[model samples]
Target: MAFESLASRLQSAFDKLRGRGKIDEQAVNEAMREVRLALLEADVNFKVVKDFVARVKERAIGQEVLKSLTPGQMVIKVVNEELTELMGGNVAKIAVAAKPPTVVMMVGLQGAGKTTTTGKLAKYLQKQNRKPLLVAGDIYRPAAIKQLQVLGEQVKAPVFTLGDQVSPVEIARQAIEHAKENHLDYVLIDTAGRLHIDEALMDELKQVREVAKPDEILLVVDAMTGQDAVNVAESFNQQLELTGVILTKLDGDTRGGAALSVKAVTGQPIKFAGMGEKLDSLEPFHPDRMASRILGMGDVLSLIEKAQEAVDTEKAKEMEKQMRQGEFTFDMFLDSMQQMRKLGPLEDILGMMPGMNKMKDLKVDEKQLGRVEAIVTSMTLKERANPDLLNASRRKRIAAGSGTSVQEVNRFIKQFEEMKKMMKQFSGMADKMQKKSKKKGFGLPFMGKSAGNLPLKERGPGFPFNFKPPFK
Candidate 1:
């Protein structure tokens, strides 16, 4: 939710235009004025905001938009396109060297999360089937080498270190040789950072860069710093000639000025973004998708990618089969919840779905999931498989075990029964639709021919508890 405030403001401005049947110059000017204020308030650089608004206004007031059948939508499209261009127009991929062991030197100021980002980047490269060797090149900070070693162990990547006694340049030089000897495909040098920019820090980083001959020097900046993040990137790029940027703490950056302005100011594309503190939360930056999200259009591509990464395809197919046959059990429900948790927070997942931005007041209580899990876990295996065994006495026992009232337990059971009925109705409806599609010699919309070919199983007993879907 990096751009939550800005998105809300922008959407409000657009809503005014959307309400009008025909847009006039005055209306466009008014909307642009609101947009300007929004950007400025979001802490975007004044020059960048001025230039962006100017470009957006020039195109929006053109005959192609003002004379269009749906002028409001046309103006919105202009803003979206310009916003995409304001950030890097295309995705900036990580640099790959012609030779083995692509060297990536991570550079940033202290407290910018540079070391953590190096670990995250190593994890990302590992997922791409590259064996990465992490170099503990930061010797100044207290326990920096130990920190990298801990992270390296967490990611299962080997850490190359020469202790704090050796010079960082020598450590980096030797680490490259170690990577080559080990047949590692990438060498990530976690360089030292200063509290602020200074000549000594720049000189040290330059020396390390010269020794490592890094194919990419990524400047990791904390997105929560707003415009200061952009300034940091600018200063680093001026001295080290940074190849790209990695904006960290983006999930907590509600203003999003850093993400929107860094590329423009430093002339370096954002190669990756740190979505969360988790090691696996680093994701390749996609400008178009980001623009879509800012405009409340929902990032479906990112959502699908998240789903593809988090959900097991084989298990999903099996789950689908069970749902169609009305055999979804408490065990399956627990498994599904665990799988969903892998995709990140429930609120964030819901935000990725189309039209969720309109429901601004929708609060997804994550603690409710834990409570349900506790309730289910309190039940015996036999009780889970056979809900009819849960009489009043059993219900009271479960309530006591789960630290809930008997009335709450009864409500949950009733909800589960209702869910089973709904699932059966949906299964029957899907069967009918598939049969009709077969007769028509085509597949159903969204769902293809695969929907018709699923092997059905015999229905199983329903668990008697009502649980709301994870996303409200």
Candidate 2:
């Protein structure tokens, strides 16, 4: 939802062009005008917005024929491409040293989430099967070292600390030696930062950098700070010659000025984005996927990646088999809910879906999923496996246990049955389609989700028990 307002505004601008069968230069200019205003309103840098609009206008006016696409669509395509380019065109990866112990210096103003971002980066490296050593070099802030230590323990990584007495320069120099001795592949130095940039802060960072000889110096900036974030990045880059940026609080930044302007202003790519507070929420920045999301085109690859990470593959397959055979039960439904929960918030999931532009704004019933889970959990194992055994009294008991009225339990039971029947019908349809096309297996792509009649983007996974996400 970072670019929610900007996306809506841009989409509205393009709607005019989309309505026209053929677009003229005047129409393209009009759309660009709206786009410029939208970007400016989003707090995007005035110069960046000016440059972006000029590029889009030049291309739209000189539009070439793209087969199977209307003139309006072509203009949109141009804008998407330009937007991608503006945000660094490709994903910039974290630098890896040729030898072990790739040194990374995390630097930014205080309160920019620099220390937390360092811990997240360590977790990310660990996920890649690399041993990362976290260096607690921020001795200035009270409890900064302890905070890093706690994060290290949470991630199961080792933390190198020298207490507050030693200089950060010495800490960095010694941390590298520790990593080398321990055979750790990456060393992340969480350097100290001031509330604002000062000569003293830069001098300390410079000294630390000289000692560490870091492969990457990442500038962590809070995206919600808008223009101030870009200005901070500019200041850091001028001194440290930062290799990349980590945009934190991006999930809360509706304006998205920092994300759009940081790289453009500082000549550094945004390597990672802090999507949430969770340790695993730091995502490698993907410019193309972001542009697609901003254009109301869902990021299917990211969605699939989330599914792959959250859902158990074997369990998903077994669940699909059961659903196809009409053996769907309360247990399976519970498992499906658990799997979906692992994928994170319904709003975020819906946003990643390709055609869910309208659905993203739907009030996410967070408690609805929890309510279903509670009801199912309150059921006996036998009752879960065989929901048919639930008579009126049993339903009443379940309602009481789950703290719901009997009517709610009855409604859930009825909806679960409907979902099972729907899954069976979908299985039959998928089989016929599979045979007709013979394209690789088209089984349920996710747990408890079927290939429904709705377009892939609009189709919410089938959780047909009270959670009415948009579906055909």
lDDT winner: 1
The all-Cα superposition gives candidate 2 an RMSD in Å to the true structure of: 3.5
List, residue by residue over 156-203, the lDDT tens digit for candidate 1: 999999999999999999999998988999999999999999999999
Root-mean-square deviation per candidate: 3.6, 3.5
Candidate 2 structure quality by residue, lDDT tens digits, 1-472: 7788887888889878776677788888888889999999899999999999998888888838233258888899999999999999999999889998899999999999988898999999988999999999999899999999999999999999989999999999999999999899999999988988999999999999999999999999999999999999998899989999999989888778988988889899999999989998999999999999888898999988889888899997797677656577888888877888788777788888875764544656777767778899999999998878999999999999999889988988888877767666666654555564346434343332344543574332455433454333
Clashing pairs in 1: 412-465, 412-466, 413-465, 415-466, 416-465, 416-466
Model 2, global lDDT: 0.85
* Model 1, runs deviating above 4 Å: 441-472
